[model samples]
Target: MTATGTTLVIGATGTTGSRTAARLMAGGHRVKAASRRATSIPGAEPVLFDWYDPATHAAALDGVDRVYLIPPVGESDPAVVMLPFLHRARTAGVQRAVLLSSSAIPEGGPAVGTVHQALPDLFQQWAVLRPSWFMQNFTDTHAHALSIREDGIIWTATDSGRVGFVDAEDIAAVAVHALTDEHAPNTDLVLTGPEALSYDDVATILTEVTGRPVVHRKLSYEQLRDRLTALVPVEFAAILAGLDRAIAEGAEDRLTDTVQRLIGRPARTLRALCEREMR
Candidate 1:
């Protein structure tokens, strides 16, 4: 028998997925936090669901009627890994899917674009949330924090282009509304913060907030990739730098009202995000 009320939240321990699960739980919805390990988080039961292992797939899909699909991280071809899971979800009689996709990549780009192509035929209802670069890059994650503590510098290939730097919390809120409501807009939604700001703007804000000197160092794509290789794999670093090049070329410079449209409120501003996030 299909699980009537539970929503399977893939990558539920991640930045966006964790927030999505919490919001779902707060709304009194049953949530299964699906991850590679049976790790526990607040507001949800843990379930083992690895993208690499199909053996763990069925148990995760079992009884769940809806899913929040997070693409495998650092994979060159995430769609290859996720398509089978989507097929399984369809076979399991899952009704709706909310896909967490990238704003940098277009609908048919190299990343989750394949899922964008396949999901329409597989699921009865779907919504894709394409959000701009997260403001949390400077606050929560290891790399950004390490940058702050050690060098007091932020580096990127964004050049002078401004991003609307949406908050992950806002993205999660939209995902919760999309997954729970039957009337969710059945199309790709590009979500961004209310104002557009450059890396310089971000660094200035961080400096002001933390009472320290924080600088934005503009690096060439190649230089950025080389530097990131010291922290992450060279291949992943290349991909990230390429996306930053896309930003530098003005791909992610525009702002959208998707967050406000979906959540009925203005998206969080970068300064506001920093005020709360920076310590």
Candidate 2:
């Protein structure tokens, strides 16, 4: 249904959240841009929200009829905090809920999967966005981007395997349809770009688009996990490293038509994104 009340966007400044919120505002949809610092957004109300703090939950829920959930980053068990907030939102009259989840994590798998499993029961009008690895990982915030800029290298355990690295914008577009369409799509969407490419292919594209030398450096799963442990918890590190290994085993070597079907446009490719960002 066409949305009537304000939609609460958690992690409003994050990769997909910011884009989703901006799209909502562009469509004249009311939005509460919820972030820890209550950061100002162009056309949405700012509200302070912290997953670890229950006090921020109630006020953020005020007058919110819809919610876009982005679980606490790096937390393996987000259901502990997520479930409680979802229950509160249900009581506060949130009719639709859209959750951002990973393509690798199924409804009942590990990590945010716990929250994915509980979302359907909490809101009858709900959808889970399971997008593949983001194309921005090479152009933005990720360590690989920093490495490419500084050392001309990209490290990963995923050797030679291809993935349909999708753009964050495509994920957000699908999310908007799920959130405000005439009828809620009560299903999980596996979003991906038009084709799969290996990191070697990515390095080639980067070199061509940016005129910079970029190389893919493959590491063993254990080595990558140990390297990541220096930056994140060992358990979470293992999970991240394991994902790379899974990719290497061809787990992510696939494409999906969800973006085209929902957004009515082909998903953006990594090369296209790189060319735009580099310019």
Q: What is the lDDT of candidate 1?
A: 0.86
Model 2 stretches with alpha carbons more than 4 Å out: 1-3
Per-residue alpha-carbon lDDT of model 2 for 1-279, expressed as tens digits? 375578899999999999999999888899999999999998999999999999999999999999999999888888998899999999999999999999989999998998899988889999999999999888887888889999999999999999999999998888888889978899999999999999999999999998989999999999999999998888899999999999999999999999998878899988899988975
User: Which numbered prediction scores highest in TM-score against the true structure?
Assistant: 2
Clashing pairs in 2: 1-182
What lDDT score goes with residue 53 in model 1?
95
- The weakest ten consecutive residues by lDDT in model 2 span 1-10
User: TM-scores of the models, in the given order?
Assistant: 0.95, 0.98
Model 2: residue 228 alpha-carbon error in angstroms? 1.0
